[model samples]
Target: MSYTPLVDAEGFAAFPAPAKLNLFLHIVGRRADGYHLLESIFQLVDAHDTVWLRVRDDGQIVHHNPMPNVPAETDLTVRAAKLLQTATGVSYGVDIRVDKRLPMGGGMGGGSSDAATVLLALNRLWHVNWQRQALMDLGLQLGADVPFFIFGRNALVEGIGEIMTPIETEATDFVVLHPPVHVPTPAIFGDPELTRNTPSLKVSLLEGTADWRVLRNDLESVAVRKYPQIAQHIQWLSQYAPARMTGSGSCVFAAFVAKDVEKNTSQNQANAVIFGLPKEMSGFVTSSLQEHQLLGFASD
Candidate 1:
């Protein structure tokens, strides 16, 4: 869905804040701050949000949206703009618009990614001149997954998703499936049975795997237990590729190497399965972006 509103000032600047998959999340421990310490590989996907900004002469951040049901103040796009204005003390404001494609509460880091894109996009549009690290630091205050979008690469993340280490792996394509449901992140996180003490593994070890063995979502079992539909989808998808839950729950994905091969296989099997979804929910493959796109704005 598109949320287009003109920022009442200079022309706009735009950026892509892509969705991410926790290839594997290990909950190693908990911190004194009531936060769980984690180790995971966060892979950025082609899925993203496009955020547009226009500088304001009056030093006041004004966030607007053309979308019918979306509230302006509650939108992450607005919060992100305010965050940049507050942190840098730049004597300027921005008029903001967000073209959202990522699904909300899908464990795809949509909101966090949008926040990161705004922080990085505004640093340039407003001439804040903060380095990448500075932008990332500013992002952490907004959300845990925010920093990953700033770096814009597949990373080994720890410490509530802040600490990052860039890693290289053979690129692959994904077939993402979104069921018609929203899974609240807090519900999964606060579950008493959620494993909070998974041991961490080294990057060197994961690189040596024959298949995605050690790479698993720590919350998958809990999510499936809570939502039986997730378990059913996983069973359906596993017939094609090694499938798993991306983040907390709701959206599950399977990876395939060749499009035709995956297609032919999926076509042959058909019991209680839905295929050829409308453009919005259609399953397809995507590669990770080397970095988030920072460029011009558009509305539709």
Candidate 2:
């Protein structure tokens, strides 16, 4: 299919690749392939990385600012663009630039979101016009989290991150902290004690009256145990509200409802802890997104 690239006055376009929170993540089972079956509520947030794209007619994927030590071929954004080019045989290339905001290894789905953004943006920029399902199928080969970003909603995600049921969640304010550490996802999942048998949540229970706190990240125990700083940070945030680790670890978050996310300081109880965060720690407040910025780019 031929497509006219959505070039602007400058001949380029930019898109947002937002971060996500596993509002609650659980491991319900394991597959024989060594992939853990999961049940989680994935919430999109305003925290995002900006991806800049300029279409190239010659079909060469180039990263204007490739990550340090990571080849353009190795980066997810470039990989996504190349994957689309390969799959569709589109005689188009792209120049990719990223204004990265989310931290690496923070379990925030930053890379996956960036990749999804590339696919969605390039689909328009290159005019491939492939269906959303096709793009998501391609994204899965990149990472488990990539599909959720493409799925484009707060979702009830399961089955090793493949199955998804869209769910409505109240937009919430969250204070997210970056623990001065990195948590390896494989190590957390590989721990013998990691809970792989947590009971599944029925849609009725999840959509009904079940509190979010009822479900917790099964990987939390493994993460906090390996890095006491994770637990310590969670404990500190717990002083204001129930705090939980998002994804595997290294970043923890607490919800805040009673105060302004931007204006609140340590003077008020709701934000006291957020603004009074330890000097050794750094974090920012963000509100949950009801839907992904790319939701309409793909048809469900």
Candidate 3:
């Protein structure tokens, strides 16, 4: 499935908002303002949510289908469009509709990615023509993870996700399991047991290293204690490969590397894992994305 924008008969452009897997998340330090500094490798994946947008000359931004319990005004997608309108003073508004496939609070960056897609899509729909960095700057105000999605590639993310450095990652297949629980990020961060002192890895060191398998999410332990379902999911998936929780919690994934000359082997392995999942468990197989679908929408 291509991430390119597709226009339907009614003139709504459907944009893909791909999800991200934190290959590993580390809480490096905390700021005076209570924001936790982080270091992580953010890997884009094919698993995504789609946002349908249509330019409105009337200057009224509206979400056609807002998530239940989340007001349209407070929704990130709407907020992103409004922010772009306010920033560039673009007279055009947007009618937004999100087809959400990624799980909420699953640490898959669903909402943040949705917001980034909105920013990128509206930049073109409204003729703002802002550079990618400018959009990223605007995205940071929405959420820390938003900028990385706008960055549009596998990245070494640091400093509360405001800093990103594009990194090379192998095209690998993964089986992602989503435990049926919403792990509140604030609760995880506020927990006294959360590790906030992991020694930061220099970007140079990361670039020099050939193997990233040793790195782990420092928040996993804290999350597992708070949400036992996450631990259960991780334990079950680990049987196939060394599985770890992505980002804060709920979704755990295990990479399946292709062996020999067979490229489909990894994907087949991932599918097999998903096929064997227990009755109550749910998951899907997805491959890493080289870059975001909307990467070229914004200028350099």
Task: Compose the digit string of candidate 1's lDDT tens values, residues 74-119.
Answer: 6766777787788878888888777878777778998898888777
147-239: candidate 3 lDDT, tens digit per residue: 999999898888877888888888889899999998888899999988899887855546766355678999999889988999999999989
Model 2, span 160-236: residue lDDT tens: 89998888886577889989899989999999998899888856555666767667899999999999999999998
- Record all residue pairs in model 3 with backbone atoms less than 3 Å apart, i.e. clashing: none
- TM-score for all models, in order of appearance: 0.82, 0.92, 0.95
Model 3, which residues run further than 4 Å from truth?
A: 1-4, 203-205, 259-263
Which pairs of residues clash in candidate 1, taking residues 3 or more apart in a chain or in different chains? Answer: none
TM-score of 3: 0.95
Residue 281 lDDT, candidate 2, scale 0-100: 87
Pick by lDDT: 1 or 2, better one? 2
Q: TM-score rank, highest first?
A: 3, 2, 1
Off by over 4 Å in 2: 1-10, 258-272
Error of 1 at 47 (Å): 1.3
By TM-score, is 1 or 3 better? 3
- The true-versus-predicted C-alpha distance at residue 31 of model 3, in Å, is 2.0
